[model samples]
Target: MTNRAAGLLLFALISFAAPLQGQQAPAEAAQAAADQLEAATVALEAAESARDRVKALTGTVRAYEAGLGAMREGLRRVARRESQLLTQLKSREDDVAELLGILQTIETSAPPVLMLHPSGPLGAARSAMMVAEVTPGLYARAEALRRDLEEVQTLRLLQQNAAGTLEKGLSGVQEARTALSAAIADRTDLPRRFTENSVRTAILISSTETLTGFASGLAEIAGGAEKITPLSVDISAQRGELDLPVEGLLLRGFEKRDAAGIARPGLLIAARPRALVSTPTAATIRYRGPLLDLGNVVILEPQPDTLFILSGLAEVYGSAGQVIPAGTPVGLMGGSAPQAGAILSLSGEGGGTDRTETLYIEVRMDNSPVDPATWFRIGKGG
Candidate 1:
């Protein structure tokens, strides 16, 4: 039999093996995987068709990036399932080899010929009895193999579809980047702001080694600048009642260590690509530009002491010192996947129903990073 056919049969036998410790029920796991795949597929379709709604090139990139993230997530889940299947198959090597031998023998002989083989009636009768004894087990194994084959086929199809979606998303991001670069080059008109010190800003950015350090330096600079806006709502009062700027899955929570073992104080939200990014509360734009490592950074001051540092954006809107209302559009997060220092949290804090665009939000008080989850109600619009 072919490797795939052998794999199916092995799955049948091993699926009946004892469940792995701490593993969820197979039905629950299967249902969850199905749900995730369906959600990712839907998000990808939406992203592919959503160019008209988001006219800005930055928004387009964000949307497509979100789609890519969803695709990656779906692929990861499929891989996990494949690994589990392989592990089960490996554990039952002897059983699988025996089954394959039986299949091979059956394929090589006709039923009538097998019944009349070797030493005639006596030997044939013994062989027939042995076959009959194992017939029930074979039937059960066959049924399981059939089910496994169908599931494997479905997963393969999903992987193919996700790869196609990712290719399209990458193309969208490329086109959007070209348009945005052109727009930036031809830029003439822009709003004025209190913290528009180009020379000092450049020096501070060059001096800082980390994003947090850069933010602290900027915060220090903003302290001396003229006040731009008065607080409209008490930021502290709205704790746990604030809505996210965009809707997507939460991949990591505040103070979580990333893949590199570096823990930053913030929440990483995986939103849909091209999804609108607004402020969770009324705030004044402190600064908006590309910082070291971060794609595009937008700093918002909802109150005198509280600064919201949002990074991983592709495009930013509003100007430094611009006072905007609550939920005002500030920028679009980058569409590109994160390279380092990002991983799903152990507690699984931010995994929402969707996985697409990733937006990082850092809350700081007096230049100290604070947990963003403590301020916003997760899994709800608020």
Candidate 2:
């Protein structure tokens, strides 16, 4: 290659090196996820008793979900980086081939002939200096290109092996969920604020056509007007500071109309199938059952006059009038969790959030519907 061509190639190679520095981030994220998964595995193994098994298993499931999510993000970044490397390499194909030929010629040429330029002795000396200057750069560039190729191979292998890891993670989470469910069923230590009168509850459900009407009659659903001790926990002081009941994307804001043009005074969240739904604060379960057309519901009274209604659950936990602590698992969202192969396929598609189930949250104060956003601190997926 001519001196100018060699100089241009060196510049391109140096420019390419800068981007390689960014590649480490994805690998670091993958390593962190692997570490998280290992910790979750250890926790799962340590859980032996039914007493704390529910909490342990819940942590395990959350850890696995976080690790799997991180891994998927890392894989996505790896795929993008690999594509960028391939494109860069392809665009410089001719330059690379010329560089290889030049290196080969230099290696095979006689020392005396390599020193002799066709122009003259002065030209030959300058050519010798140029060769000395450019040879090392060419080799260095070739080494960088080799490393890039290796990285592509490494990324491809990582993706291929990820399927197994994801499968194991999926299986682990499912087992944890099953174990948690069994543990919750066997639990009998939680304090009950009052007993739900099934007869009265049924009558209330039959009489009420809307959630507002049903919530208004929750007090009458108890067996009798027992003078129950009020809860000490105050949720009014926690406005705009409570975490969401589940990890999910905020689909529709409060009172945001859907395609059907019907708007409701609630927040709709898009969550992954079978995702854990927990209470954001210590509250009394006013009701826990199917209500109207909103599927299964869990109504929590965190204070005297305030109610937090969570709808769209597939499996409800805790009995009506039970006092549960904050972060206690209340239910699981509907739909089956995606299989490992399906998860891998979805990751490959570069899709947005993989949420398939929806949770509707409504807040009520003194029997009046209010925006849930005023109470929950909603983020990207929480």
Candidate 3:
């Protein structure tokens, strides 16, 4: 072959060569992974226990929702592995025929017959040189096959684990949905602070200037000193212990810059569509309506002076001035579950609405924006 052709052929052969083998993860990465898995497992177990003990469906609903949130990290791990496994499987499939041919030749060839077939010294020398060239390729092919088999076994185990996880997640979601419906039905007689007129709400949405401005106006109209009772777990004391309102990857941290390069004083959570959002603490709904930039907004007061502003909802469930218990259903993010045969696309920083449902959470004390990362157990969505 010409030098260029030989180089190309060698490159093709190397493409199917044995992958450099080592521990699947580095020590640090593995440790971090273990920690995350442990956290997810703990959350799952807690949710299951809570669901079983709950006397009302409402409590079960919250537990189930929390379980789904916990499952997200595990699912994300599976998805990441799934991509890697696919690439490895494709490479092995591509090289299967070639590797089989090499194995067959090695298995059938007899050394004595090959040595006798070379009639002269020159012939033998040529044969030796040819043998020398082929030996390394044979070794490489054998190594590749061995690695491929090992990889296949690993992939099989991962697939089995993932299947079980997925089944549990699906079951949990179904039960949660059913329980939520029952809970809503049971609470049909619950009194509202004041009913919102759809016409006025729509008009307000159309006339709003900024999300913050609209929310500030609503707070003024709601008027008077805050009346909501304090939660049993003090907000300050529960720092870094607060649950996220929704299950999602933390796309943007407090004061992190967005796609427009503008830094915001809130967390942007990227979640799956229609993911249920629950209150992290007991709070009276200060405002629940749409804003100009934000799709739908719910401002809550966990304490008299502490405001939790949660925006980017597709549907708002609570009403203005209505007190909600901790873990109460607040609203929902836009989007449906990963549809059958549809791709589950992940998002990066500044995730858009098309692929991922994004929620914005901002905390304020005495009406000044504060970092929410300090208060919540922040983690990247699985």
Candidate 4:
């Protein structure tokens, strides 16, 4: 199946996989990511300087974070406003309900009219006339109460719609902020690891020879994001000198995986440094933007035959038409908590929901995912 079709197929598979554990509004998420990332950046700045830099940056970062705190507080206040609105509407609803109840009771308990003894009665006609007048007044009151009830329902609907909009916006802000923070943390630590002498690195890849047949639906004439390049693998060790380009916590192997979970990983490097990504080729940047729960997204098509969807990152390096080597930094990991959802999805104390920024990586061979695990040995074992 085509890569797009494959995704659709998987999507059709009930999408019963673990659902993303977040339900935050865009605004809330954004604010949270931004604050955390800014703090990490400040720390990096502090690391780069001597004596007072840390101290100075500590305050600056604190202030920046505090500012975000203030904004969050404002949002809360708005939420509170919504609550107040709800309260107001509730009160009106209660009032209407009470009035309706009284009307209903009266309608059910209305006394039966007594027949007037017109032949021998004294003041009998006048008594019957009085009863008839009272009945009209009761009917009028009940009708008025029903109208009140209807009005209350209309008000409730309007208030509900408004609240939904605000809530969604809040969630978005939260997601965005959290992802931003994770990216900052990744970038800040990059220079340190690359310069560390004790750091280790590795390049795990498969080799191909006599390659042929690589093109796209829009082949023969393409521009903007279609400049093909061949990627060569260098897996040999160099006289005890490690060719790995990173330090600290490398993921040992590519977890081997197949369309049906039928494979295993060749290597799974645990403890990978958060500085950069390992890609095989230099490709064109096709898309770059914020992806709600995924953080910053970058699409690189290395060849007419191959493409990469790199996401779950905070900061992206190298823009469109830029050259990035195998170990080039595409972006910072969205968060380093093993799973992207730990920090991004959490709000303070996990009161509302969980969120994590995940960089969705999908490789396409002419618009189809060719099971990256087969090549990288990522999904082989697990």
Candidate 5:
């Protein structure tokens, strides 16, 4: 390959290499991550508690509805009572008027003048007349009518007080219901989403250690392993300017979880052409789909073994199984400035009983993951 081609090839190879950082996190990033976890946990727990509150509020609302029903009934009763009292007052008024009219007519009529011969019949009539005269009856009826008027006035006042009481209670009940509704709104997103966030965070935490280990071996060749395969590239133009694919910052370095230079997936190398821009890379079609994250992953296949996964460029444009010549675009090299490396057990979360998705590329002597560096060349600019 010409100098330009070699440089371009180097850029592709370096694209997936990670830089190692020792075991501590930057204070700011660590603090921020901690805060986020705290917030997420609180939110999730609150949401769980909300289920109970929601239930309680629902019950309270139902109770209020029942109370409203009874209040409405009471209001109806009060209305009927007022009507009844009014009817009673009106009938009493009519009876009083009738009595007064009878009194007036009686008063207007001339007194019956009986000519007594100063005898026995006169004496008997005088005694009987005192007891039988309509005047006393009229007076008694007038007194009874006055009492009824007073009683009706008193009953009207009582009805007024009862209606007022009912109105006040209803207002209080309505206010309580409105407060309950506001509380329900405040508690709205309490539980389900909270749980999901926790799950996502946990997965991220598990990857932390592996990322550390992979960073340390960056730029170094993998130890000679049986399954690892290294590809060399060269460019005829632009030489050094376009070949190395390190973005900038070091995301994470070697740690407990890193899968570098050890297991079946032993080693991996990925590439992205910086200067070979004119030639549309065939790697784009070679790795596509769920290989999505592989966004241009480096899988070195030896003359003797299955695929050994290394790393991916931030962006990819290929699917697996398609064969192509060298010098392809593969993908873009722009993830972490330096790149991140993580070692996952073959039994990574989604890996299930069988190993899958973990960076621990399965070593397949015939068909399994052995240590990878044994088979391939993993140099700074492979």
Candidate 6:
């Protein structure tokens, strides 16, 4: 190869390999996920005898979900990086072959013959210097190619072995969910603000046509029963700072119109199937069950006049009168969890949406609808 050609080839090789140096490898992300999964497994074991098993199991399930999410992202990145490396190698095929030929010829040629040039000793000396300068670059390029190939192989193996890890994680999360449900059912420690009168609640549900009207009659649902002291938890300072009740993507902002062009004073969150929905703040369940056209609903009273309405749940928990703590699981979003194979395939496909379930959240202050985004932080968790 001419001096110019050698310089250009080395520059191209260096450029191709440069990005790999500073960028974080997929293995680090995958390893972090593995660590998270291991911690969740330990938490799950500890939850069995925990004083508050519901809380313990909830954390365990969330940890598992987070780990699985990270693992999926890591795999997607691995696939993309591998594809990029392959394309770069394929595009430089001719250059690489030429480089190899030049290196081989230089290695095989006797030193005496290499030193003899057509233009005598001066020309020969210059040619020798050029060869010496280019040889190191050629070896470096070869080493870079070798590393890329090894990385591709490693990524493929990681993907292959990921299925078993994913399966275990899915199973573990499901078990934690089941255990959490049982724990919640057995929980009787929560104080009741007032016992719900089923007869009155049913009558109110039948009479109301809109959420506004339904919420207006919420107090009457308790009938003439004596009321216990309300929860002392104050959430005024938490406005615009509370985490979302669920992990999801913000599908629609406050009052954003839907497909039908109807606007509502709430936020729409798109979540994965059967994702856990919890309370962002300590609150009493004002109502819990099917209402209007919405799915299973849980209306919470965080203060005297402020209410948080969460709808579209597949399974609702807690009674209307019970006061639950923050991060308490109230229900689960509808739909079946994706199978392990499906999840792995989706990750490989990359950037495909698996958030099939939607959760509608509304915040009502002084019995008037307000944007939920004002009260809860957006874009974090959900």
For all candidates in order, the CA lDDT equals 0.62, 0.81, 0.60, 0.38, 0.34, 0.84
Write down the TM-score for model 1: 0.52
Tens digit of per-residue lDDT, candidate 2, span 1-382: 3466557656655654644556667656766776777777777777655357777777777887787677767767777777788998999898777767778888898888777766778877877777778677767877888888888888788778778777777777787788778888887888998899999999999998999899888888778865556797676778999999998889899989999999999999998888899999889999998999999999999888889999999999889988888888899998988877776666544634578799999999999999898899988862
User: Can you give the TM-score per candidate against the true fold?
Assistant: 0.52, 0.93, 0.58, 0.27, 0.24, 0.94
Residue-level lDDT tens digits of model 6 in 1-382:
3556557656655665654673347767776887788889899999999998989999988998888778777777777777877898899888777777777777898889888877788888887787777677667878877888888788778878888888888889899989998899999999887889999999999999999999988888886865546667678998998888888888898889999999989999988887899999899999999999997999999888899999999998889899998999999898988777887677656442777889999999989999888898897342
* Model 4 vs. true fold: TM: 0.27
Candidate 5 lDDT over 1-382, as tens digits, reads 1233223323323431222232112222323333333343343334334655544433343343333333333333334443544665575565445546545654564544232324456654753364245356546655544654554455345434444433433443344334444554454332210111333334443443543232222112222322223223322132223322221212222222343633223333232222111111112121122232333344333223233344444443323333333333233333221111111111112211111112222223444545433432223431
Q: What lDDT tens digits, residue by residue, belong to model 3 across residues 1-382?
A: 1233234334446765556454343222323433444444444445544533223444544444444433343334445554565676676674555555544654676865445433566665656565557557756765765665665566446444444444554555556555554454345433444444556556556677865555555533433434333444456788789999987788889888888999999999887776778889887777777666767888887876778889998877756757677878777677665521222233111223333788999988776788998888898554
- Runs in model 6 lying further than 4 Å from the true structure: 1-19, 116-120, 226-229, 349-352, 380-382
TM-score of model number 6: 0.94
Question: On a 0 to 100 scale, what is the lDDT of residue 111 in model 1?
Answer: 77
Scanning candidate 2 in windows of ten residues, the lowest lDDT window is 12-21
Q: Weakest 10 consecutive residues, lDDT, candidate 1? A: 339-348
Per the 3 Å backbone cut-off, how many clashing residue pairs does candidate 4 have? 70
Model 4 lDDT per residue over 193-238, tens place: 0111111101100111211212132222224323334334333222
In order of TM-score, best first, we have: 6, 2, 3, 1, 4, 5
Evaluated against the true structure, the overall lDDT of model 3 is: 0.60
Residue-level error in angstroms, candidate 5, position 352: 64
Candidate 4: C-alpha RMSD after superposition: 20.3
Angstrom error of the Cα, residue 137, model 1: value is 3.9
